[model samples]
Target: MQRLVLRRKEFSLFQAFIYKNIGISLGDHKIYLVQARLAKRVKQLGLESFGEYYDFLVADRKGGELEYLSSLISTNVTSFFREHKQWEFLKSHLASILERSGGRLRIWSAACSSGEEPYSIAMFLAEHLPNMTQYDIKILATDVSPKVLKIAMSGMYSQKACMSLSDEYLRKYFSPVLVENEAYYQISDMLKKQIIFREFNLVTGDYDLFAQKAFDIIFCRNVMIYFDRPTQNKLVDRFHAILAKEGHLFIGSSEALTDMKKEFKSKSASIYQKA
Candidate 1:
């Protein structure tokens, strides 16, 4: 059988398919990238062309192929304190925010990839909030990738992932371990207990899990670039609705609310406050 290759026409078809199906907009310039990401699947299925692969994906209902598609397209590279300044701001204001909230704190790490961001939030809370044990402090960590969510649930990381972490943090929050001939560190039970991980898609517009509960803080950083302007506005509106009055929304450093509604006011760099 001849090897299958993704051509321009098939790539355009896929761009339309993904945009209509999942709201992911891929430009014509991404043809090479599409080919690279899906070539392996094509070969594995013994497909003759990218069109067949596209059809297979469209007809796939078991979610295996959909999951693969998400993995290929979603950007998940993150680290502990990737945006250090944001963490610094959180640390500075968390105490006052918690106090004003009547000792209850609800934070959401939206699109939390591989858990570092949520765990970092948990650690900061654990360290600064002395009366944290008395309050109802919860961190809702969500992501679209089931594969990444599984890793996040495990709360384990390699030394490389922990390199930026200070020695004190490592000693205070994590315990070193060797699992399956690999060196890694696992988050302490104290920090792990404060977080709840689940799979969620921001594009779905269903937030029933947080229907009754409004968050005091939501860190939806860096995930919106994948979405189009209209989708971005819709998701931001949802965030505004779900956030409590004066709640903080932290986006990626590079992402801005160019077309965002007037309900949110810019509070700081890449930070917005509900109006």
Candidate 2:
């Protein structure tokens, strides 16, 4: 199989398409990244070049190929409790959050790749909240890709995927199983029932779909780094609009709200409170 070089012109077309349709800003340095990631797909689809693949994607009226492209270009690298300090912050503030919301909790895990974050939220609340069954708790986990959402809905993880979790959490929240002679763990139904997974595009999806001041916490971590500053500010503004008063927003440690307008007060590094 001949490796298709993603020519500069072809790269520009994809770069524009991604920015226009998906809201991700690809810098010139990312040309190699795009070429490397899309090469396998180009080969698998029997397409000769990235340009042809791009055309096929545009011709995909149902937006399926575009979704696949989004999945490929976008980073979905996530794990359960990826940001340790944020969790510690949440632990310290859980009592006040619960009191303010009167025991009803609503959370949105935006760009929730492969379910670990939302599952972690569910498990965290169950472990910390007293008499968890007596409260109304719902977690909405969303991502742009259906492929990863399907994996999330299955609530199954390989032994390797469960590495970051504690032995107690693994024993309590997951059931060990074998799939084709490989060790796997299934998330308990109690946790699964608390979450609803859906497809969403942070850049292009309708924000009107969400109620104003609906969420107590919004986890849009690690994803904003892919967008340009304007997109990042707009995303932060939307998060601020939807979060309940004093609600917290947790972003990736590598990200910051420093240059953006001060709609949210910095509670900690990468953690902000709606003011």
Candidate 3:
């Protein structure tokens, strides 16, 4: 098979399309990177050129191809308890958060790549809170890609994925399973029931669906670095709008709201409270 090259023109079209739909800013130098990432899919589909794939995506009225494209371009490098500092902050303020909520809490794990974030949230709460079933807590885990959501719904993980978790968490939250004689850890149904997974495109999804709802905590970490400034500001504003009073927003420590004016007051590194 002849190597398919993503021409400059095709790269420009994809760059604009991705930014418009997903709010990701791919630089001009990323032409090769995009090509390398997407070339296999293009080849598997028997497409002759990247331009043809673009046309296919445009003609895909159901938006499935675009979701697949989003998956390829976006990295899904996540693990159990990836951000240690954020959890520490949450632990410090957990009592106040519970007091404010009065035993009811809603958390949104935005861009929940492969379900580890929400699952970790469930496990953490079960570990920290006094009663196992007293509080009302639910996690809404959403992502733009359906492919990842399917994996999340399965609640299965490789042994490598379980490395970050503690032995106690492993014993309480997960069950060891043998899949074709290979070891795998599957999250217990008790924890799985605590989460609701859905397909949500943060850049293009409608916020009106949340007009009547507000979350106590939102975890939109490590995702904004892919977006440009204007896009980031717009997305941040949406998050601010849907957060309950004094609700918390957790972002990646590396990603900061430097020049943006907003209602959130910084409490700690990458942790914000709605004012």
Clash number by candidate, in order? 0, 0, 0
Report the CA-based lDDT of candidate 2 relative to the real structure: 0.91
**Residue range 158-196, candidate 2, lDDT tens digits:** 988999999999999999999999999999998999999
- Candidate 3 RMSD to the real structure: 1.0
In order of lDDT, best first, we have 2, 3, 1
- Candidate 2 lands at a TM-score of 0.97
Q: Residues 162-256, candidate 1, lDDT per residue (tens digit)?
A: 99999999999999999898999999998888899988878863677678999999999988888888878878988998999889999999999
Best by TM-score: 3
Against the correct fold, how does model 3 do in TM-score? 0.97
lDDT of 3 by residue, 26-119 (tens): 9999999999999999888999989999999889999889989989998888999888999988889998998998878999999999999999
For candidate 3, list the clashing residue pairs, or say none: none
Query: Estimated TM-score per prediction?
Result: 0.94, 0.97, 0.97
Off by over 4 Å in 3: none
CA RMSD of all predictions: 1.7, 1.2, 1.0
